[model samples]
Target: MELLNQIKENAKKANKKIVLPEGTEERTLKATEILLKEGIAQIILLGNPETVKANAASLGVCIDGATIVDPATDSNRDAYADIMVEIRKKKGLTKEKALDMLNDPLCFGPIMIKAGHADGEVAGAINATGDVLRPAFQFVKTLPGMSVVSGAFLMFLKDKTFGHEGVMVFSDCAVMPETNDKQLAEIAVATAKTAKAIVGMDPKVAMLSFSTKGSAKHDVVDKVANATKIAQEMAPEFKIDGELQLDAAIVEEVAALKAPESPVAGKANVLIFPSLEAGNIGYKLVQRLAGAQAVGPVLQGMAAPINDLSRGCSVSDIVNLVAITATQAAG
Candidate 1:
């Protein structure tokens, strides 16, 4: 099925309230339109009201004024500040800092969700990754039973080499800089849950590394092995294995030669990396160099579905992430 179809179906089920920062972008406005027309969400757009209108007019897109939430005109500003101060009382927030954050777009969006004004948020179409994440940590928080917030990419491919055509999830690419065995295990299980929730399938997770099984010896090898053990213990129902190279995890002949006993080898859909460097570089290599359409660095393990978009993302990208965010919120 097409990724957009999955998104539309999820949006119908979730009916989430979504907040968009820097809502004047062509893609952002178009996404807002789709969300409303499809009943996928009730959206709040952030920016100057007139400016948003003018931009939409310039792009030949029209947004209902009632749906746009201008921070400058928001009557709930002080209330939002109070909520932010309350949530970050331990973070050393003073009344002044609280007010400052409430005025900031980054903080305001998540604060809206925390205060029940919105169900989820989608940002980073024109912001940095950290700019997107800082507010999420401050307000949205980690999901219950989850540790630190980590992330993954939903890689969209042209061919259905795997059971599902079009896309598969690969995670921990955006959050963890260098994950230990326990962290990797958490990433695997968390990603599996994310896949199941959004894509509606039990994930076969592959803990990918430079070596397969006992053929290689190093700290990294030990890390993958330990991660495999932890993942099995934490989510035994998930099909998971580790220390397999890329080819071995996804290719049939490689699985036969390298690690024939592994359940996930050659059949894994979600791939976990030992470090952020590898995850980021690996995914980019496939997307840019090896010819695949990479859709996300979707933030996971959060209390709600909050996602970041590339600054250069198109209207379609924003629409897709909003769909993903709605699904996350529904769960």
Candidate 2:
């Protein structure tokens, strides 16, 4: 939890504006009240102002410090709609359709970021992942020279000997069911950035696979190896290596035997899984079995930070992710 505390401190310094689309959602409202009290980040709640206040009052939480925007009645709705039209011109988006779309808080949140009204967004408490992400992908898109948007989790384990003082970053866990080598490379690079910016760790990335330096050969292993190469080339400044097994990535003895020549094998703090299925399974296993704290699926590689949340997330989870998003926006 020191990591989240640190993130909160960083967020306070950044003081970035972050929009919460699920303003009427209980956890989101509660988290917004806490964020407002702590001055962790500027809060923008998207909904009908009166309804948002009534919900907060009913829940005995005061969200007086937050900015409440009713997308349906805001003066900027016309401009946001026009921006949407322009962004979707090729898809033949109409102003009327864009205006109607903005009524959905999920869509309004991203459009706010796109128009510089807000720096980032956190949603998905009362929405599905696709609904939360579709507008983001359509509007915010990916960061420059990045064609992929991936999710990364900051894994904090009870045992201190593994990873960077027991904290490792795992990626593509909540998005990208499958990827080609190029997309995998982007995941690796983006995850490293996330680890550094959000977790405050110097990232030594390991492109993960079943094989350790080709001990066992397969197309999947080759994909990981190729991704490692591409990631290294694309980000020459970072220490990155791969086709490493999980043990080889974190165990010095296994790394010494399996990937002796690799700089990152024994010391990796960022793990880029070969697929979403693997990433999801690997993180959950460690979280439940090893008693590790899994903090994210922090959406990365977007032009602006727009993170998704699990519908089952707690108030603390929302607060922590908003802090992370603020830090990402700062970077």
Candidate 3:
């Protein structure tokens, strides 16, 4: 909570404008109220204006400061549709199809970002991950030199017992089922940047596996090792080491016996898992068992600051994500 407060403070300074596509949902509506009251960011809500107003009124929430756009009736609908046609023309999208797609807020929200109508977008509280991400991939796309978009969680533990005083990053937990060495390297680089920008840490990245510094021999070990090398080559100034087991990466005593020569060993704040299965399982274990606050599966490598929320997220989660998105936009 302390770390989140610091992030919120930083976000407040950014004063970014964030669009919420799931505006009609109760959690989103409630979160918007806090965002407005706190002056966290300029808020835009996408939905039918009448429905949104009615819902907020009944829920005793005030959206006086928010801009509500009814995509169905907004005058910009045609203009946005035209923009989509131009952007997606190479993929065989026609004006008719673009107009149809614009009817959905999922598509419309990202289109708004690409068209410069908003700084960033947040959605998926009531939508699937694909519904939120597919449009972003088509509209916002990836940043320069990035091959794929990945997801990471900023794990904030209560005790400073491990990994950069209890704040660590776990990557590829929500996207990319499988990644090659190059993709893994990209994930490391991107995760490091996220750690610095969002978590306010100088990142020490660990490419994690079941082996420690070539102590075990396997193709999977080699993949992680190669990825570490590529990541180091990509960011020569960043501190990174790899092919380490979880213990060697975060446990000081074990690191001394296993990877004594590695700078990132036992002090790593950013962990890059070799596979999605491992990453997902690892984060959930820490989140559930360790009682750590897992904020995100925040989408990284996008050209803009668009994010996806878990469908089961709470109002607080929505609020925190807005702050994180705002900070990203600021950067």
Candidate 4:
């Protein structure tokens, strides 16, 4: 079976509840239909009930098994507002302000997850990255022991002759435009966990840089090298190495020549790029040129399973992400 099918199967077994904040969007409604039909998860669509039903009818989509909650009029509004005010009171959030914010599904969705009303959330179809993530950061918060929230992609390639049978985790691809050594270490740890949970792999992390093992001396190389050290200290059980060039990290021949002594050099399945520029560009290049199915920019380090979708994503993308989120929530 394909990776997405495999994920959908696993998600059905998990049977989580995933919330869609962009419930009124056409793509979201369409994906909800498939998710419900397939029993992937119980779904909560956040929008006006009448509007969501009308949209579904207009789109010729059936959201029969999904629950629709109108943030503007739901009975849970008062309880959610109270929760938000309690969580953000230090930020000077008044009950009136919190109630007003709840009118936006983006804010309400994460609140549902935080309140145990939903197992996970998948949004960003029509919302900005910040619009989707800020609520998660504020309400859902980070996982214990994690200080930074990052993003990663599960890169599945058509050819299996490469790293980890052409399955790899590319980290910090959509978040943290730049990272310090500490934040990079945090990203590495979170990504290792993400790979194990979502990709079913024992993570061998490669902290990528332009240089390999002292072959160059720029501060950029030093940053990656330092992050590798910190990640090692933070997660000694993980197989990790760096300041490696991309080739030296994944190609055995190049590893033998350039980083022969490194345990993770050529066997790495988690590629931790030094910055968002490298990660974002690298994933897109592979997706466009290598025929790899880049399945995420999935958010990690949050306490609950909250994912962000590209605004350009198709209905299938939404379906896949909901399954992925269900799997994450299951774990």
Predicted candidate 2 versus true structure: per-residue lDDT over 1-331, tens digit per residue: 7878989999999999999998888999999999999999999998888899999999999998899999889899999999999999999999999999999999999999999999999998889999999999999899899998898998999998878789999999998999999999999999888887777789999988889888899999999989989999999988899889988998889889998998988888888899999999999999999999888779988999999998889999999999999998998
Pairs in clash, predicted candidate 3: none
TM-score of predicted model 3?
A: 0.98
Tens-digit lDDT string for candidate 3 (11-44): 8898888999998999999999999998888999
lDDT, candidate 1, at 147 = 76
The Cα error of candidate 1 at residue 101, in Å, is: 1.3
Q: Write down the lDDT of every candidate, Cα atoms only.
A: 0.82, 0.91, 0.91, 0.91
Residue 258 in candidate 4 has what lDDT?
99
- lDDT for model 3 comes to 0.91
Over 184-276, each residue of candidate 1 has an lDDT whose tens digit, in order, gives 888889989888877776688888888888788898889998999999999998898887898998888989999899888888788888889
What's the TM-score of every candidate structure? 0.94, 0.98, 0.98, 0.98
Q: Which stretches of model 3 miss by more than 4 angstroms? A: none
Question: What's model 4's overall lDDT?
Answer: 0.91
In model 2, where is the ten-residue run with the lowest total lDDT? 192-201
